[model samples]
Target: MRYLVRDRMLAFHEEAWVETEHRQRLFKVNRKLLRLRTTFDFVDTEGRQMASIVKKALTFHHTILIKQDGENVGRISKRKFRIFGDRYKVTLRGGRRLRIAGNLWDREFDIADDSGTLAHISRRWFTIRDAYAIDVMSEPDWLLLVILAVCVDHIIEDREGEQLTNL
Candidate 1:
């Protein structure tokens, strides 16, 4: 399966959606702001809650917990001391772990398991809007992968906004 993840350009907070190649909406991602904690809500096309990504504060590296139906499903944490580029350690449901590495600035990256590649994400596929493509390679955990993609996007956006403020 493949999906297109796009951010709302004019929105005040982080809001995005996942769409099919033909532009059919698949999931809606909503980020909660002005709250005690950071949380991202992922809802299906039919408006049912799918998962919640909650940020865990006060960590040496960025860490987030992926929850579904109030149960912890996964964890996403940044890899530290990378001199070359950014990398992430993703712990999916059932304790399956994967490493994500590539050029986050260009929005081109891949997730790989011990066996092989699982998903490829790139922005070069589209130039019209702030969107990226996720190509899932026969992966049954596509939903978790998409949510992780959005989580990475949120981290990048927050970092960019911080840079702008410091300028």
Candidate 2:
């Protein structure tokens, strides 16, 4: 399964639409404003809350929590002391661990589980705003994948902002 994630144009708040390859809406990503830590809510087309991604406050590394129905289902956190490309750990609820390794700058990466590559994410898809393509090879964990994509974008943006200030 694959999906197209696109950001809304000219919006004050962060908003995006998660659609099928045929342009059918599947989910909505809305950033909650005025919060201490960055947060996003993912809702189904019927307007039902599906999951949420929240950045942890005051963390040394980029840490994000994925919650479904108010329960922590997974997490995306940066690996420590990495000098090369970006790395992240995705821990599912039942202690299963997945590794996220890729180049954040190019917004291309792959997630692997014990069996093998579970999904591949790439921003090669053309769009007016930031957009990406998610190719799911295995059984789909839709919300988790979406949150990971958003987290990657935020992590890269934050790093760029820091570099700008240091200049």
Candidate 3:
């Protein structure tokens, strides 16, 4: 399964769409504004909340929690200290671990575990600028794959913002 993720910068708040390859909208990535913690809600086409990617506050390393039905289904956290490219860890509630590795800053990477690659996030499609598609290989975890891609994007943006300073 492949899904297109497009940023809607023109909106009053941060917003985006998770759509099908043919451009059929599947989910709306709505950023919640004026909140203590950074958050984004993934809503289905029928206006139902599918899941939420919430930035965990007061943490040393960047961490985003994926919640479904108010339960922590999975988590994406930046791994501390790496000699080469940046690395992230995805932990599922089931105690399974997946690692995100590759040119994450460029949005080209792979989400995989000990078993194998779960999904591939890339810009090879290049339909829209800053837009990327997640080619999900595992059928059962498609939602997790889609939401994981967005969580990676959010973490990257957050790190970039933290690097700036007023001098």
Better of 1 and 2 by lDDT: 1
lDDT of 3: 0.89
Q: Candidate 2 vs candidate 3: which has greater lDDT?
A: 3
**Model 2 residue 46 lDDT score:** 92
**CA lDDT of each candidate?**
0.85, 0.82, 0.89
Clashing pairs in 1: none
- Tens-digit per-residue lDDT, 2-25, candidate 2: 878898878999899988778999
Candidate 3 stretches with Cα past 4 Å from truth are: none
**1-167 in candidate 1: lDDT tens per residue?**
88999888889998888999889998888999988778999999889999999987667788889999999998989854568789999987777898888889887889888998888988887875589999998468788888888888777777788789999
Each candidate structure's TM-score, on Cα atoms with residue i matched to residue i, is 0.91, 0.91, 0.93
Candidate whose lDDT is highest: 3
Give per-residue CA lDDT, model 3, range 1-167, as digits (tens). Answer: 88899998678999999998899999999999888899999999999999998997888878899999999999899855567889999899989999998897777999999999999999877967768999999989999999999999888877777776431
Look at candidate 3 and tell me the lDDT of residue 65: 93
Task: Judge candidate 2 at residue 153 and give its lDDT.
Answer: 73
Clashes of each: 0, 0, 0
The alpha-carbon lDDT assigned to residue 100 of candidate 1 equals 84
Q: TM-score rank, highest first?
A: 3, 2, 1
